[model samples]
Target: MQNEAQYKELKEWRSQHIQAYLTDNKKLNQFHDELMRKVFNKAFQTIKKQSGEPPCAFLWFVVGSAGRREQGVASDQDHGLVYETKSKKYETYFKSLGEELSFGLNEVGYPYCEGNVMSSNKVWRKSLEEWEEQLLEWMDSQSWESMRYLQIFYDARSIVGEEKYITTLKNKVHDFKKGHPTLLRRFLDNMMHVKKAVGPFGQIFVEDNGAHKDSIHIKNAAFMPYVNSVRLLSIKEGIHATSTLGRLSELCLLPGYKELKPYYENFERLLSYRVSLFKASTTYDEVHYLNIKKLSKDEKKEVKHILKNGRKLHEYVQKIIKKGC
Candidate 1:
């Protein structure tokens, strides 16, 4: 795994990160960023050795948790590649490079994406022209599944190669969104399900079946409201920042706002809650499910309070977009 100097340094840093997280949880995100840079470099060296440096310019980007810089101890790979030019030979070169990049990271840690959202997949690897065309097609269709992938693209950040390649795509999305604002309704619609964190009776909605029986899905139930709502706002306002909190920070300055960014405040609290959940977990899978039964009376109250705020923020943002006011 440590075939390179950077990878060896990353291994040492990861060990220190594990120890430091005991005192401060925020350090984990920083470590993930450093780890990804090294991984990208490793991928590059592997490609250079095997393919003799890329024949053309390209960009490599990450999506999902790594894209958001919110990765926990265990995560999977969700990445893509965009080459500067499109050609049969160049595409062939990139297709091989994509496989090398994917497996190279897998060799160290991050498992290949279960959904095939990796560089090895054709859908995630393309030329700049193809990416722009694909984005336009997805936005035009306004389909839930298509829009979902579009949202994932919103989280993309370059790990290797020319970052402007990724920036151009982001700006294209922002530009397309400017003229077609009504798409907000469809975007809002796509975000409207599977976000249940609290019941109508003002209680935590724990799972009743499956392996996670009696546990709450912190990822969807708690985090998605903040993530999805901020994403919709970013799409509407054309903010390019990928993180949910970063999105909220940019939105808070919009011309007229009487309230303190409650959504922002609440999201910060939720991150702390997630850190607590991760600290107590013994396995990677356990990090997603918070055992609400373990929370004290006061902690339970705060959880419900945060849940209620999330629902309110999402509804408020939806109304704002719907009115176009």
Candidate 2:
């Protein structure tokens, strides 16, 4: 099928059925996964019409929330491309595919990443060897930008082509960390501070002004503590899973990380709370904003409890990583 036809089909499906999945996080993400894979495959076919056949095997993968299988009702694109080898001919062919995929996803409703992390960027479209080199460069760099890039890439999951490409790249990161144990501290410093949600007075903070005035930024203030802390622990332990919950599960099995079990429950509740509260969101920003006035007293109390536990989880991971390093 042509790209426009695929886009129309996807848009129709989303408009008619997305509302049903919004209240359930797992189902919603599964919906995104299916839609994205269809786009990926169709984009390839469209590109093939122009470029003939692929010059080499390649992988197109998603990072960020999509990569972790934790997408909201509204999400933007965060993806990259990795082909088997280097050459100007291969580069030209895959670059066209990358641009097609990005445009295709956007036309079908996914927004372009503001950070420009999409596969359409030259930095994110690389040969396998180039990707390895870029990973090493990011790993060795002290700059915050490079570290942020590294962390973003850590969450990548292939949506099309060979999965082993991503697996190999992730293992490279793990091996690098293992050889340079102190790199964990750098990661710790980069990720340790989460936005303060609850105040010393035990009141939750809300935006003082703007479109989301009086609303809490739940994604930053609550979700990141659990997500980033668990991610750090996963890196330190050489756990290769990308999802926060998946990392927590792997952690709970280890002798050193049995204490993480409660935090697992807390994170689970956080996911449920987010999806339940944000089901009405029609924009990406709205998905992260929770207006305090709309929440029931019991719901507010539950949010406070989750925020408190998130802080505790953050501190626990910090202490453990510091002690081990």
Candidate 3:
């Protein structure tokens, strides 16, 4: 009754037809999200059948890559739970549900999060009030770790049951920031240290001596600045789109960004490179590191343009923050 059978179909499609789906980054993410939702529903139904019923209304939300709907072919579980009431009964039920979902995803090729950012982790599973308290504490602390966690939560998207739980919480965050405009600068500081992917003289930087020696860390160098900068601006502007491209398009409505045209073009080029890179990515680790030696002259030039524009984007966002609400 829970559409549990969809998991098998989803897994088979991913395993067998991945090459066909690899062309569009947006479609790839949408496919991943669809499968994840099926997985979550199956876990919920399976758990409830075994344990009678949930003690209260609860919602499951996805975070991290899944939350943004911007995942690559290989992504892990990053999720959380928000039950309506906090009690021993509800806690036990949701935690059990969390483990089932995580294990279920692992069985179907998606890895468990290395950081344990999954709903199975106690830190990520909470009642609605507890989550509100936790968010407030995180905002108050303003430590590096707190900021990291807050950013993760800010990207969350509700996947199953009581979607408003996540929506209201997201609204709370928006309101908190609205009341505290200066915090954008703090977030800007946290995002400023993107690794230098392209060096002076337009050279592509690579790892010199490691397992991935001579490979470029595209996640940090190529993707993060674009994603992170767009995220900061979207948050400041209260634009609710989560995907990098979606956020950029929304930002276009503001002055100085015409249809989000310029930045979107650069990010689109970068995404195409990432998609092409996936053809050679046999393993998860291989997806985020580009082989500098492999890029043709035009591709390398495009990569440099992406890096330059990304830096420009972040600097522009900083200026917007300084200009204030």
Q: Highest lDDT, which number?
A: 2
Candidate 3, overall lDDT? 0.81
What's the lDDT for all of these models?
Answer: 0.78, 0.88, 0.81
| TM-score ranking, high to low | 2, 3, 1
TM-score of 2: 0.96
Q: How far is each candidate from the true structure, as Cα RMSD in Å?
A: 2.9, 1.6, 2.8
TM-score of each: 0.90, 0.96, 0.92
Which candidate leads the pack in TM-score?
2
lDDT of 2 by residue, 68-136 (tens): 888888899999999999999999998898898888889888999999999899999999999999999
How far residue 60's Cα lies from its native spot in candidate 2, in Å, is 1.0
TM-score of 1: 0.90
Superposed on all Cα atoms, model 2 deviates from the true structure by an RMSD in Å of 1.6
